[model samples]
Target: MLSPLGVSYLGLDDEGFAHFLRGTGAPFASVGALTFLFALLSLGRWGLRVMLSQKHPYEPWLWDHSWRHELQDQRLTQLLVSWPVSLVLLAVLAVVHWLFYSRVFSQGHVLPGALLGLVLLGFDIIIFTRVLGPTVLGTLALLRFGRMRLLLPGVPLELGSRCQVHLEARSLARMSNVKVELRRIREWAETTGCGDERLTQSVTHIEHSHTYTVDAAALHEGKALALPLELPEGGPEHSTALHASRSCHWELKLSSEVSSVHLDTTFVLPVYYVVGGHPARAS
Candidate 1:
């Protein structure tokens, strides 16, 4: 029996109503609701950051510039473009699993070892597809755009000196609006929260940036792209410690606006400060 509010039990004794409240909804009402609300708020903040960054391409601080020294390729952006196809494939896989594989697994006729092997095979296929898909796409990109590599000068780059960087590539006449950026990134690991639930998070921020645009037509028939960047004297110098908890480093980011295949990659740059004819020491 329900009361006028439709929640109060009219027929239940005090103890019975207490038990119903404890088992069904009290925990969610008192604790889970607040946790869910906070999660939604955090998600909203992240979404806002993404939208703002996409809207303003020139602004680097609007986006999270996480530092990674790995060589980046066109496949990273291509993967974003392939998301729709991946999602459709995932939906079809889910349907097939629900309609056939789940029922087949429920039947006791198959041996446990064989069933385990089949599951393992499915996982292997998924992993192979993920690895191969990116490689195939990246290979096609390499064929179309050709190869490009950064050519740094033999002399070391100082904190406050102007440096000349070169990009060796072919068919620059076809590419348009080639851009280069020298970004200084500072990252550190911070421990948050109390003992048992302590969470260690690495935080990164772009401290200084120098952007330059190259005119593709200015390049001679078979000449490389020359990038001249002036480093700031006031900015923090590169840290000497490799495994320090906090450190700053420089990176060279290159991009182009082409019709079919565009070049986008980042390279680690070594920038040091000289003090008394010696490199500055890190504390």
Candidate 2:
């Protein structure tokens, strides 16, 4: 019923479709196997480099830390953590495929959908395990490296107590006129327990201290300024304790004369008890 050219075109399309389906298994298997093999080879190479470098001479000054070094450390750490999990997942997927194929063939029904689902699932797992998961975890780990201790107070304090937080900075000779802001975080009642009315009111309140300025010379020399935090007259009641914790966030904006460099760090403070004689247990 078809014209000669039309029939030839239809035949070509059918041939192409059949070839695709036939080679599907080969491509999937090859890609997965190759990816796993390449990852393994890369791991080996990095391991060898680390091992060989250990025996080589090193200099203390060369250990100067930067963002790139931090990033590499994070990548190695993530690879070590996630690679085993990915291998186990791959093995499980293989077992599942074998089981599905056996059962479906014995039942005399085609499980095209199951086969397709397995392929999709395998691809998703491989990509996520190898790429996305490692990238996210590495980024978070790197960000938390030097930044964590900067913001935490050096000393611990009981809840409801007040403490003074110090802010320090180093400026170059050409820098001047920097603005700084401090943010306070209030503790909240445990979500699981019945919401405490007094705790709610205490945390909802906002109290702020004055702002201070640092000269260019003082900043260049890395001098620090201190500000005292005031506590409420009475600590939190027996049922409610002062929810104020001693942590402050700082933001520095430099004038045009100075280079726009942003520095953030946490300061740790000793815990204090306000009206309440004792610290409230974490809920």
Candidate 3:
């Protein structure tokens, strides 16, 4: 005995109604699966772009350390990384969908599973787009607001050696009360607790700092005002070394009174020292 809205009202038997429904709606369900697949690939691409943003393949030095060559290399490698592996997860999802489809229609039940699959796919896409859209838009807005240039004697300043630093600034509008500074930072990570309870945390020490105030008149005249700094050797190479457990670093900072807002920019000084040799390599 068939029911109200389907084949039963028209006098078809239960098995014939089931066959008609499954065979007819199967095409639409397959299309939904394909849509979900496209959304998954798109979300993966965006995640790879964000994860690799911190990697600058064009760095003056260390450009090719572990395949930091093309942006796509990072994306492809991340796509293949273990744990929540994309292809594996996709295969698992496919298997689950097929099982649910068979269980629903083959067992003479059709009230929910097919529709739920489409709902789940749409929900995931909604969540992904919502999170990704704002983050990308805001980052682009910030980059649009400033143009910056910093000059350095070079990377890896020698211990107890004097080095010259130059910083130049230009803006679309007049900027005033500009200042520049060189700061030495010593940083390390410490692990506390034990076993499964263990946790790692960072430590930072402001070893020393020197500041230079720019003449307001120079900025107004508009010839790319140059601010210079002289730094003597502090010690140690950057923590970027693969074997390093601690890092010693320096930062060059710039701040200017722009309209009513203070604009600030900072650059890390990548200096290293050589034993019984020379100061940090020339910037």
Candidate 4:
């Protein structure tokens, strides 16, 4: 039947009937199919880009490895797997009717098939917006917030090497009894299995000055330190740095009574080299 969009006719032998279908059903089917295909192609392209990104592990069956990792959080895998199946089934039904049951086209089945395909297409769009859309946004947020800069002595440290850590806290006003603790990551291979090792200590008092030196070799082998600073009731502006052997997982927690507390922590590692039978900075 040819709707305003394309050609749709039950039989070419009947010119009048063919013309009518062409004017209505044909156009409607063509427009609907084009819209559906456009949406599918767009989604497919997006899926490809996500799959190829650095953070994503290459997995054809999954949209993105990060999404798969979060499957348990939002049941995204189930939806992604089922949506395509539904679309494919509806498309196959339409194709079969067009090839073998041309008479059904005039009998009104074509319109329903086209409508169903459009509906499925709409559903896919909604799924993208409600499911993948938010997931992508959240991933971006995590990337921005969870970013850590591992500074070395004018260079980058290898995965297994030991280096000094410079921990700093920024803007610590309106907080009391504030304490900072550094916990080394135990589960990751880089963290030398020392679970939650305590590496240093700092107190957010008026002076706001404290420092500790730790063996990076021991820290990398899984040893970490927890540095807790007690902030005053009114709290003072504060920042601190520490020298540690390896980079470890760290977290910040403010006291419940403390309000409007701001903290910025950074880890700085120093580089070492072997020169003239002694270890020295690369520079």
Candidate 5:
């Protein structure tokens, strides 16, 4: 039987549920329910913050956009992004606790394995930093390229077509030498095996590439740099059309390095023929 709230159970299974009860905390089921709820809350909070940032950005609840008054917002957006990660870590910890109670693991084994799990999640965090870093820390604090406008000769960009590209970028500080590369990259995941026992692998392929030098003169006022490049046929199979990746994708990759940090970005575009992609909306 379960509580009226449907959160905790009164009776127990002799093995799994009973064993779970005798741990450090009481009423493990209630705790588990709360953990998931907290996780959902974290997810919701971050998502709401993301939407709000685009609008109010920073605010004085009583007034408005208080963040604008200051050159920098004191609140760290990275912490907001990290709250959900804590929930993930908690969920994993609970699972580790379950593994111990289930007798599937020994006491010593659980600690190391749980630590390994945390380490892996720690690694996954770099993704958030890279993705949201530019936004959270501002454009100058991170390497960012914006408003990349590519001009192609007559037809849609295709095999052996030479073109000029222009874009604006921001960097943490000025460097003596900076280089830019434009390339087409293909990435996809493939799964092998049957039903529940399948294996998936991530694959990234660089189909074409060209490099240019961005001189310090253009860095003045974050000016757009004009680059000249030539394209090679990615393949007979790959289309010039840049489309969002479902299982596979062909992306226009723009990248560079500043100091020790690798700064790169990609735009979806058609580099071949007739592959369908979403078109830009005109204002």
Candidate 6:
């Protein structure tokens, strides 16, 4: 049977399906199967490492790694993973179209072929808009505002203290309604189910937050606005683990209206707890 997404499922018993999967000799099928197996093994290894680290308390380098570096790494990683997955989906679509065309042409069936062609066209539009379109738009947006930058203090933010930040932009003089918000977030992963049916998902919670508005006069002067934010007291400290399974951190979100354009951006903040003039434990 074919689903709304044009995915066809064969009605077979578990053992028969296993046999069918084992008998398949398609190159793309083999690649996908191997990739799934590799992913399963990698997840198992990562879970084992997480369990071991809990017992032996190893410090994560994320504490020392600057948020700017993390931001860059995240963007690069997204591009790397998204491009390959998008290309693979497009290839699969091509393979499915070819197979459908061959079988339907041999049977001289125009109706089924036309229906499947429409379905494939729908899938093509979805893939382009959801994957390829966002990538192109993000690249263009980066190019448009490549010169604008939000500068933060080099020293890490301590709990119950204040930190200074600024936005440097040559075009900000023409913008108005500048707003900034600092948010504290807690994140973790929860797993459900047992054995091969297990599933894991990441969760985020906003623990604390604050917002500030830049003065219109600052924009009129065409100078960078010095933004100072106060950290909340008696809250969780910044903590990150392997594969980012659990963590607490802060982010600064900025927005402004510039004539026909609206500018919005977010930056990760380095917020850590300090004790006796030294970085302390995570809460």
Using TM-score, give the best candidate's number.
6
Model 1 TM-score?
0.53
Model 2 whole-model lDDT (C-alpha atoms): 0.40
lDDT of 3 by residue, 123-162 (tens): 5476446543433433342343344555555554444556
**Candidate 2 Cα misplacement greater than 4 A, ranges:** 1-165, 168-180, 186-217, 227-234, 237-258, 264-271, 275-283
* Candidate whose lDDT is highest: 6
Q: Rank the candidates by TM-score, best first.
A: 6, 1, 3, 5, 2, 4
Higher-ranked by lDDT: 1 or 6: 6
**Ten contiguous residues minimizing lDDT sum, candidate 3:** 64-73
lDDT of each: 0.58, 0.40, 0.51, 0.35, 0.46, 0.61
- Across 135-251, the per-residue lDDT of candidate 5 in tens digits comes to 444344332433234333333345455676554555325444446666666666778998899999877787666676656456455664565656664443454322234222334
**lDDT (10s digit) by residue, model 2, range 1-283:** 3334322322223443343335345545755787799799978765754554354313111111111211111234555555555555555455544544543344443455355556758786876877657655555443432222122243223343455544343334555544434333344433343556433322333243335554445545655434445433323221121222422221222122333333322232323232233333221
- The per-residue C-alpha lDDT of model 5 at residue 18 equals 45
Per-residue lDDT of model 4, residues 1-283, tens digit only: 2342333333223453454444456545755786798799978877765556434222212221222111112224444544454455445445544542454345556665466457656765776676556555544433332322222232322222343433222222332232333322211113233558734433222222233332223223333222322222211001111112322222222111223222233332211223342332211
Ten residues in sequence with the least summed lDDT for candidate 5: 61-70
Winner by TM-score between candidate 4 and candidate 1: 1
Candidate 1: list runs displaced more than 4 Å: 1-137, 218-220, 235-242
Better-scoring candidate (lDDT), 1 or 2:
1
lDDT, residue 200, model 1: 91
Instruction: Compose the digit string of candidate 6's lDDT tens values, residues 1-283.
Output: 2232232333333443343334443647756876998799978776766665465332323333324522321343455667677767776766666556654445565666677678879988999999987666555544444445666665556778876777665545566557888887778888999999999998889877788787646645767667788877753345322244466667788777665445666777666666665555464
Better of 2 and 3 by lDDT: 3
